[model samples]
Target chain A: SQKTINPNYSNRGMTLEEDINESNLYYLTNGIAVIHKKPTPVQIVSVDYPKRSAAVIKEAYFKQQSTTDYNGVYRGKYIDFEAKETKNKTSFPLQNFHEHQIEHMKAVVKQGGICFVLLRFTNSDEVFLLEAKHLFPYWDESIKGGRKSIPKKIIETIGYHVPIHLHPRIDYLKVIDHLYFNQ
Target chain B: SQKTINPNYSNRGMTLEEDINESNLYYLTNGIAVIHKKPTPVQIVSVDYPKRSAAVIKEAYFKQQSTTDYNGVYRGKYIDFEAKETKNKTSFPLQNFHEHQIEHMKAVVKQGGICFVLLRFTNSDEVFLLEAKHLFPYWDESIKGGRKSIPKKIIETIGYHVPIHLHPRIDYLKVIDHLYFNQ
Candidate 1:
């Protein structure tokens, strides 16, 4: 019964991924955007094929995603980003992101795609949209033995605040429109 | 083992997927494009987490993809497509495409994204890049008692011939550039 329950974002207990997925569904249904979370990569080592039933994956392991979690077409531009939430009250840990994902975001930015990250502070329920360009310097500094986490105070300065809404729960596209389209 | 062999495109034995993968890698390496094949969707049912080892997926099944197999950005545009190879020499069967993939293509096209399908006739070793707009009419007619397949001759007229090359084996972006960018 609990598994069949419809996702309701009225309660603030929903994870960041759930909130974004619901928002993406709303965007898709309204013809506003077509963003989707990429499927988890799995390495299927062996499978069993029954004569009359569906094939079953008997052995498999999860693989590292080579790119960001979410990407799609929005307003004729390529949209790509990773969504992360932190429980820490003071800073967002850079360890939440992998080095390969950073490189992938750089590639997306080089191709002129709209690349960004959605960082949420779970304690305060605050979400910010930080562009990939603004994040590169932090990543570069971390490799040189700089701080491995970004202070919440600095994040608020450079990132756009994404206010939550009822229809599209996260409403990150509004932030994109304001930052890029001047709408 | 044969699995360890390096992918060499000088010969013609490689599948359409392999060709496109190598092409995407070349494009990514050269900063030409950022296309990637989406991983196969799997519905995980159970997992076994050993204390000292990786979490192993104990039960899973393949899930039908709701979108195309491949998508990414190119020249600041959202590019999306599905690739299928048929052994038939005279016609390409429409059954190879799922209903939801067509719907997904329609959404991408509406968003002004470049959407198309790569049809490869394995018998004749020919590949054609047919835009989603061009394929829609045939799909519509099929539901109203029209032919369930597109003739190879018709494909030649309606689609662009993707010439094979050494570095980027498929060279599908050339067709995109010529048709969309007039380059």
Candidate 2:
């Protein structure tokens, strides 16, 4: 018996992370943007240094990030954003974002940076770039006895639908260009 | 015999890292800027999850960062830089910078972001913010049969001396404001 390989094996269930990372790499290589996903924060409790080699971390724990996931410079402006994916078809749950992330976004917006969330409806394979300003109202509403989720209908209306492209899988900057730069 | 505690125990002989971290925190709290030191990259080989609050990383190695250590948004612009300390009094060695960092800086500068190196001469207790534009020539020269280090006198003349203050210990943005923002 021989192993049968599926035609779409490589990309059968490509993750949102993989898509965005590929897009960022594409943007970086083309000199279009200088975006990067900040490395995962870890708290190292102990380390052992070998004689001639690098230090080996013996004990560590994952630390919660104080800021958003991805951030960088684009066209002389600061770009900050968080990327999230949901399996639900109807709405994106508010639980995906932390209070600290919201605060970080608020700070980023306060400092004149473009802040947004790249929300992916994994089931639908649709992506949207929702601005931080739009997110705040919903986030605040949730805290004050409002709906705990943003309906897909409202997101479809308010958020720019990001199209997936060949070179850049998720061409989010195209949406940003249209929304911010008008070009 | 009782151990005598020095009055300047906390402040005396503070490393450049401590000064910058304090300054960044101050800037963040004051809403002046949103700068952060990127977390140290770690390549986790094993993780142990014992049905606890957090996953513990058991075995990991420090990963070399592909980009600079510090980056953030400041006054609607992308700010990116690396902080380095040198004990040598006469010159700043070119070997301190990796090729990847130089490439990253070049990419950032090309994208119209503010890029620089925060260099500290520990012996002299002096710090300088040397712009990426000024650094490239010396970097290129070193590759083309030129001096492997930038002389102290040259750095003193070209780079902006970052003044240490009470609130923000290493007030580097002040130099940026003077150089780039015309404030």
Candidate 3:
């Protein structure tokens, strides 16, 4: 049944990555927000062109990233974020983030960008948009012998739950509108 | 001498990539902007651990990129672009750009993000930022039997010349302030 459905179509129960991408696309098309996934860059060393239409990369290496995975502007405010999914329902580990990423988020917030993390609990099918201001104390506490992670309970208290929808899939901007605009 | 110099020092005479990166770093550190170079993603098929410190990537494949190389938010506006260099002194061939990249830039522009190309004529030691709106027609014209490329002279007429500087390296934000902020 999944095979019979359109591969790129939005209606087949999307993953968190797919859902966020679809929601961003909806936002873009409707002129609501302009967010994009930065391209995954790879260094190519060798390629085999066995056929004109088929070029196979034979050797390559992943380069260290100097930036976040997603960023853009929303309602004249800079928004920067990274998304991660975990199967565990109990706690979200600090180890999920890299040192450079934490440093990057701090820089974004300093520059007045609305920085956040999108955490998805796959088993429970829940997603939350947790702002960086809330994340900062925990990030620092992480170094001070706090739990090596933020428990799901804290996330539930501070972060806004992004609802899943049939049309837009993630529909996170709606939550943004409510949290940032309506308030 | 180059090795003894602190590669990360802001005051050092950095290379072109270094300048762009440091400018981006300056933007990040100052909270004036949030821009970054995306990581190159590679599919690692094999790895060898001959030494504890260095993990040699034995086999890998370069992954195709889905978007432009650099993008971020500045003063609440999304900025997206690709950086390119050419040895040709007179003309920059259109073939250097992929169809997917053009499509990606178009999408960003359509979504109200500032989209453009940061081109460098290495031979002439000049760099220019050419807007997408100015480039699209030329791209179309080239495909339809007009000039197969955009000459440096034409670019000089249309593009905003990015001034070289000590701190912000590329110093494209100055051009942005003049074009968008002044308006």
Docking level for model 1: medium
* Sort by TM-score, top down from the best: 1, 2, 3
Ranking 1 against 3 by DockQ, winner? 1
What is the lDDT, from 0 to 100, of the residue A114 in candidate 3? 73
The segments of candidate 3 whose C-alpha lies over 4 angstroms from its true place after superposition are A1-15, A22-34, A39-66, A73-77, A88-90, B1-19, B29-31, B41-58
TM per candidate = 0.94, 0.93, 0.77
Superpose all Cα atoms of candidate 1 onto the true structure and report the RMSD in Å to 1 decimal: 5.9
What's the alpha carbon RMSD for model 2? Answer: 6.8
**Candidate 1, which segments miss by more than 4 Å at Cα?**
A1-11, B1-11
Model 2 alpha-carbon drift over 4 Å, by segment: A1-11, B1-11
Which 10 consecutive residues of model 3 chain A have the lowest summed lDDT? A1-10
- How are the candidates ranked when ordered by DockQ, highest leading? 1, 2, 3
DockQ of each: 0.78, 0.75, 0.33
B49 Cα displacement, candidate 2 (Å) = 2.0
Cα deviation of B90, candidate 2, in Å? 1.2
C-alpha lDDT of residue A101 in model 3: 80
The sequence of per-residue lDDT tens digits that candidate 2 reaches over residues B1-109 is 1112233332357788788899999999999999999988999999999884678889999988899999998999999999998999999999999989999999999
Tens-digit lDDT string for candidate 2 (A1-183): 111222332233778888889999999999999999999999999999999998999999999888999999999899999999999999999989999999999999999999999998887677889999999999999989899999998998889888676658888998899888997
lDDT of 2 at B179: 89
